[model samples]
Target: MEDNSRSKNRREFIQSGMRLSLALALGSVSGLALSKVVKDEYVWQIDPFECTQCGRCATECVMTPSAVKCVHAYDLCGYCDLCGGYFKPDANQLSTAAENQLCPTAAIERRFIEEPYFEYIINEDLCIGCAKCVEGCTAFGNGSLHLQIIHDICLNCNECAIARVCPSNAIKRVKAENSYLIKGDFSKEQES
Candidate 1:
């Protein structure tokens, strides 16, 4: 009788173990089916028009040195020798002197284009996204200089730190294909 009881107990334990294993496998499968896979379908972008150049981008981004960089729209650019984006308002001369430069990082590189035009290029590595150049450009010249998210440097966080803190609500999630909001493109569209 004792042997019979032990055998029954062993059978019950084996059945319970098998049931638990089956339940676990089914639960795992159900979880996988219910869960949605997230692809890299979207990325963070800044609309140049919406941006107020509040200078928050330089400090609010999660990445040290920030993934934001200045992009100069050559087509929109007047290519002025005395670029408002490059030179301080009180500049003594239209020279490459650090004192006369508006960019604190000296990111805007000036090159002589013609008698009066000078092409300004942004050094992405040196740009701090301070928007001082953007403000200066808009205030005194054609608004060609603007900030853009460098996707290669950007982590593409689900919730971007800069977007949350943006005073102007400029930052937004964009389709990866249409990530960059170029200044000249918008201007051309509006002109047409």
Candidate 2:
């Protein structure tokens, strides 16, 4: 009986130890899975204010045409017929001619809003992320033209090639819900 009691106690102790080990393993696996779910909420982005528009976005992105595209802040735009962002600096006339356009792809489409005012829109498919329009607008216009990451086309690489080579460190991870850093929004923040 004494031997049998000792054997039972040993069996119980082994079972208890196994149970504790299993619980710990399960808890650790759960924690790791939860962390991954939390991480999925964020995506890579470009901070417009920090971006120098060195034209690296056009060349350094892993994607062929690049996931970076030009974004226009119409609210902050002056709607000028002679848009600095839309027309070449040496444009022969402020007309809607392909030759007079600053963008190599002719991505910018101008629609007459009224006399001396035209609404400019960027065709993302045609944009090459060259930043020429952005440079021209910021230098000579209301600074509405800017670059932004198009998440739809982005591969969301673990280590972004463009971010690594970015001269201004403009690229960063941002929450998926509020990914875009609009030019108008940045201007408002600077004022405050």
Who wins the TM-score comparison?
Answer: 1
Regions of model 2 farther than 4 Å from truth: 1-40, 186-192
The residue-by-residue lDDT of candidate 2 on 1-192, one tens digit each, is: 999999999999999999999999999999998787765467889888898879999999889899999999888899988888999999999888899999999999999878878999999999999999998898899888999999999998988899999988999988888878888876787799
Model 1 residue 149 CA deviation (Å) reads 0.7
User: Which ranges of candidate 1 are over 4 A from the true structure?
Assistant: 1-40, 189-192
Clash number by candidate, in order? 0, 0
- lDDT winner among the candidates? 1
**C-alpha TM-scores of all predictions:** 0.79, 0.78
Clashing residue pairs, candidate 2? none
Q: What Cα-based lDDT does every candidate model obtain?
A: 0.91, 0.90
lDDT of 1 at 105: 89
